[model samples]
Target: MPSIDLQETGLRALNTTLQSVEQKDAAYTITNPMGAHAIACGLTHEINVTIEGHAGFYCAGMNQRANVTVKGHAGVGLAENMMSGTVRVTGNASQSAGATAHGGLLIIEGDASSRCGISMKGIDIVVGGSVGHMSGFMAQAGNLVICGDAGEALGDSIYEAVIYVQGTVESLGADCEEKPMDEEHIKSLTGLLALSGINAKAEAFKRYGSARTLYNFQPDNAGDY
Candidate 1:
């Protein structure tokens, strides 16, 4: 394991060192992040990285194979456009967490701000706490598991993606509606919860997804578009 202090090595140099490492299952510990932007973006190796403190915007964006753990809160766009592997935040996250991610598992142990998992593509996000408004907006695929409450306009214009909320929902977005959970949903949710290490019952959640009404354009529903 190697430790890099952001206050000493600088951001670019730290990223360069992490990116350049080709060893499999290599581990790194980053100290004194101090809310720096893009702390460990674009890491393709199957390494493990631990951030000692808070991370700023776009932390761990475009990550592939590498596993990133944030010990503190994360700023906006956490794990944006990630390809694969895991990104875990032990504390709260700002808006648009896991936005436009392709494939990966994002675990937020605390609350997430507005637009969490917005425009997500094939990413599986598990939020241990609540999420703000407009979450899962225009999500194309994957699953968003919210262990706590959800704000207004949840899953607006959602496509194919599934949302599971264990707590209260303020409102549903356009084309989004509550759906019955079947055995398949239960199985998936069980796996996700177990993988995220969240002690929540799958049966306690309510499933929500696209009603498929807005898949095509309709003149009578122009306001929704």
Candidate 2:
């Protein structure tokens, strides 16, 4: 295990060392992050990184095969465009928490602001607390599980991605509607919750997805466009 104090090492050096192939499988402890931006971005190795304090914008962006844990809150774009592995935030996250991420899991133990999983491709996001409006807007694929209440226009203009909310939803977005919770969905939610380590029950959640009505242009539905 190695420890780096961001106050002394600077953000550039910290990211450089974490991205090194020579440090494969190493465990690193970063102290006094003090809300620094891009704390551990672009890591391509199977290593463990622990950020001991709050992190600023784009923390762990473009991450691949690395487990990054933030002991405190995370700022905007947390784990944006990540490919694999895991990114866990023990506290709340700002807007666009997992924007455009292609794969892997993102676990936010606390609340998340607006656009939580916007345009997500294949990532699985599990939010232990509430999320703001338009959480899954334009999501092309993957699953988003919200353990708490959702704000207005949840899953706005969504695509193939699925959303599971355990609490009340203020509203549903255009082309997004609540769907039946069949056995397949129950099984999937069970696995996702288990992976996230959240104690919420799968049966308590309601599923939402695209109605496929906006896939093409139609004069009758033109107003929705």
Question: Best by TM-score, which number?
Answer: 1
**Candidate 2 residues 1-51, lDDT tens each?**
789999999999999989985566789999999999999999999999999
Which residue pairs in model 2 clash with each other?
none
Name model 1 segments beyond 4 Å from true.
222-225
TM-score of 2: 0.97
Q: Residue pairs in steric clash, candidate 1?
A: none
Report how far off residue 66 is in candidate 1 (Å).
0.4
Best by lDDT: 1
Error at 65, model 2, angstroms: 0.6
TM-score of each: 0.98, 0.97
Task: Tell me model 1's lDDT, rounded to 2 decimals.
Answer: 0.97
lDDT of 1 by residue, 1-225 (tens): 899999999999999999998899999999999999999999999999999999999999999999999999999999999999999999999999999999999999999999999999999999999999999999999999999999999999999999999999999999999999999999999999999999999999999999999898899978866
Clash counts for the predictions, in order: 0, 0
